[model samples]
Target: MGRSPCCDKVGLKKGPWTPEEDQKLLAYIEEHGHGSWRALPAKAGLERCGKSCRLRWTNYLRPDIKRGKFSMQEEQTIIQLHALLGNRWSAIATHLPKRTDNEIKNYWNTHLKKRLDKMGIDPVTHKPKNDAILSNEGHSKSASNLSHMAQWESARLEAEARLVRESKLRTSHSSSPSLQHSLIGTSASSSSSSAPVLPSSTRYLDHAWNNGSSTSTVATRMSDLESPTSTLSENNVPPIMTSVIEFVGSSERGMVKEEGEREWNKGFQESTTHLGEYKDGMENSMPFTSSLHELTVTMATTWGSSTTSAHAHGHVSEDGFTNLLLNSNSDHRSLSSEGGGDSNNNCHGNSSDGGNGTGNELYEDNKIYWNNILNLMNCSSPSDSPMF
Candidate 1:
């Protein structure tokens, strides 16, 4: 079959569209409207191809195009849309009426995506890009999924921490109470030890996650997070998200803040007090992913054996946080291994603890072994659960 007509570069000029070319294209469209983009270039007396002409008109010369710095509202829309749709700029552009897909794509690549990376977030998954999380997944399906969600939560905290630092800097220079208030998101009367809550958009992502919404639904919820003001109030932040955010987002990130001010030579005691204690043991290990899924399961399951369960699998770190270390580091093997795919296949022939065990007991032991390590973190929910 012949190549698609669109891709065939026959005799069309392909390069920057000059002012004269733009004028000719614009004049043709203005006089008789853009009938068909593929045929419009030829009719407009331009040497450019249809794709080039279409891009030039839509991105630059369109009568409805809004040319200037993007307002905060537009920015939020773009962030929310990009989160839901990934790189589908054309679809993202439909809701953003005066903007072109090309414009939104460029803005994302040049701006928001970069900021997310600086904040330790993976722009594609909207999750943390830490190798520890990926390596920890190993080959277990349940552990892998939980670890992925944990990664998302971690990424969120990381981004929020950056925002808090930025907000602190912004507040230091400007006396605008309202701008400061919006950025702070919580009352000054709140406990100084409390972590700063996430922005409305972050909270919205959490909401979408909790509800198990699809991409389309995620886009819809993004619209609900909108407000006439660029800065959303703390009232808009959900309690579940805030309770967790205040802890994880504030503590470790404080270490970075203190380092950013090292010229003063602040002591460790002063840093912990100004921030929160960095008791990042196994559970507090990275201050993010270690305890999420496991803790959530613990809170949702039986609670009477919490202490016994803790002792069964994990050890206590110096900081007193249970360093479960994602099922005590036994669930995962390094994916880099040649036989990483089935690391345990040979183990099926081995006998049980007593060596003379029958098949029934071995079956139950196998079942329990794979269910999960020990799940007895004493807490009420993901936010309140004891670290790891």
Candidate 2:
């Protein structure tokens, strides 16, 4: 069956409403709420259709509706909300209290849309025109890696959130001794009757324990409070390890001795012989900066030997950057012991006292380039960022 029109078109008066008609509609609605717009026209004693009457009341005649030019704040609010919600004007209207969806739509079309277009923003996407153009470029390998990391972080957060909710639920369930005991009994019986099931937080820990030979990759470093776990896979996705690792690392590890602790002990204990040498090597390892300094010097020396350069001896050489970093440490010690003034800084050569402007510029550009690479490398590890 076809849906009926809001009101019959034959007898209805439409378009601009007269002042007399507006008064009649407003008076009726004020006395009794505008219930069922289909029936409102007859009850309000107006020739206008119910849809027209409803629009007039909601858009203009409503006492709460703010009629005036949109303020700077309101315009900004509309633009932001439009970006999020798109053409759903009714949804946007909810956020901008006292404004009608119709009014906002008109304002955006007549004013804001043209302004944003002039400023090189895509009104629909609310992003720069240049960004939109660049976005059309296909995803790179680095983009794929970033997406994988993002998915992992999202899953970790979601699992942690679920664990919190369950913890709260458990706390509430434990408040009544009888209920707690009953629930425990039921869970025990069910587990004993069938295969034992684990909580989502503990499931990954169990998987890690059982799968002893699974290799662990360090995506993130361990905190002071917790030791990092070996990664376990189910369908090749890393399992939720955050809460389980925290629980195991905390004082609560002692409580799970019968179940989790035994499996955890047995799993890692079997690999101790193979890991012993690695552990010893770690204990004897140099600090990261010292290790990096040595690596950089070795790499630069090799690179300089392999490649040809036209630069003069005093200018920044291929190996000069490595030497610069190496000298910085020695200079720090020298500055501490002797006066800071007399040391001949080989890093800058004569560039320190305003000689070799071109060399200084080249050095600065190289410095910035290397610093950007180092920053990108640092960002690859989740442990470095607080957001992760």
Distance from true location, Cα of 224 in model 2, Å: 42
lDDT of 2 by residue, 52-141 (tens): 988898788876566787665456556644543467565455445467779999999998788768755678765445443333111122
Global Cα lDDT for candidate 1: 0.40
TM-score of each: 0.38, 0.38
Q: RMSDs, each prediction?
A: 17.8, 24.0
Where model 1 places Cα greater than 4 Å from the true spot, the runs are: 4-10, 131-388
Cα lDDT over the full model 2: 0.41
Clashing pairs in 1: 195-246
lDDT of each residue in 238-260, candidate 1, tens digit only: 33222222222222111111132
RMSD of 1: 17.8
Model 1 lDDT-worst window of ten: 372-381
